[model samples]
Target: MSYEFITLKQEGRVLTISLNRPPTNPLNGVFGQELFKAFSEAEQMEDITVVIITSALEKAFIAGADIKEMAAQDAAEAEQFSKLLQGANNILNRMKKIVIAAINGHALGGGCELALACDYRLMTSGKALIGLPEAGLGIIPGAGGTQRLPRLVGLSKALDILLRGRTMSPQEALAIGLVDKLIEPENFQAEVMQFAQELAAGAGKALGYIKAAVYEGIDFPLEQALAVERKYSAENSKTHDAKEGLTAFVEKRRPEFKNE
Candidate 1:
């Protein structure tokens, strides 16, 4: 399959999708459209048990949205652009398979929102940074940034970062729970691939359910969250993978997961 602004490469159960417009992979209408199509396909691919969002270039994961494109657009055009981007962002958040952001370098504005949409984020050490600095650009983060960032970090922290419009180092981001893992710059790709493969090797169905439960339950009331967990647990229990997992445990052998 061909993608205009991205590259999709699959190795084993891990599907690596890299932003192709390098140096600074700036998001645009075309990139948003292609991302929606690419990630939607990834969500449906049973063989792709895990997806890693990364950049092909060594510099930055994504600098932010294309300022040139936005500068030329009118209010109506900008709204349409935001809608497309938000739609794709929602698809990423709701994807059943785990999505991990391999933050090789800077992630700002839309870039930060992209990482926030993922199930997990692993940032490269050294100069790499992640933050939503849209306020500096005279705009707010229109792509799930406002909501997700607050939930990931605390309300006060998220507000402070947004208000300051300052970028954060990888270490600072990790401390605030913005990124789950931090790795050396040289080991970034290898470590991300290994992590994704490890996730793929486990019970795939269970992973999906766990992701769903946490994401859905987070927004629900206490009782409602418990019900959501019960519902997902029941759904997961019906899968053949769940049965095989239990049986393999009893037999004291590694269980083969088919992502059923």
Candidate 2:
């Protein structure tokens, strides 16, 4: 299906979804819904082993939530707004495939939260800043920002950013674990796709299970976390990829994963 707010392209095992709105890729209700739909489609496609979320423009990954749209909302409308935003975010978070957020530029407010939802984030080295500044506008972050940010960067740092409504530089973000890696702006796309391809070549179901265990299990008690890890790992061991990997190890040869 054609999308108005985003562009979805499939290249081999990787699916690319680019924010098409220029300057500020504002996240509106419709945009969020469409993004969720796009992801839904990508998730069901067996050939799409990895998903790379990016921006079409060089100026910004996403400027922020669409403030104009927010201004037009009442309490009931606000509830609907939050649902749409959360819905898209939930899909991204629970996706089984590797989802990489490629921050080509600044990611502000909801944009920042969106990036936080990804399995991994690769940022472009430059002046790109990331933050949730909703508090500055007299509104708390309606997305998962409050919860995810603190979990990502610690409570103290997350509180400082939210309360101060300040943006963090790419280097600072890297230091706080907000981003996994940085790529020079000149080689950003290539670096991101290379990483995505690397992910695509791995065991798809195993990767998803590992990602789930790390992200979700981290929040549980130590014993509970270990249980979760074991459960997923045991399940992954049943896949054909796991069998091939074991066989290859025994043979002392490299394994070619089918992403099963």
lDDT of 2 by residue, 24-100 (tens): 89988888888889888887888778999999987799879889889999999888888877778878877778899
The deviation in Å at residue 39 for candidate 2 is 1.7
lDDT by candidate, in order shown: 0.89, 0.88
What candidate 1 gets wrong by more than 4 Å, as runs, is none
Question: Which regions of candidate 2 fall more than 4 Å away from where they truly are?
Answer: none
RMSD of each: 1.1, 1.4
| TM-score per model over all chains | 0.97, 0.95
For 149-212, candidate 1 gives per-residue lDDT tens digits of: 9998999999999888878998999899999988998888989999999999888888988998
Count the clashes in each prediction: 0, 0
User: What TM-score, to 2 decimals, does candidate 1 have?
Assistant: 0.97
Lowest lDDT block of 10, candidate 1 = 87-96
Q: Show the lowest summed lDDT stretch of 10 residues, model 2.
A: 87-96
With a 3 Å backbone cut-off (N, CA, C), the pairs that clash in candidate 2 are none
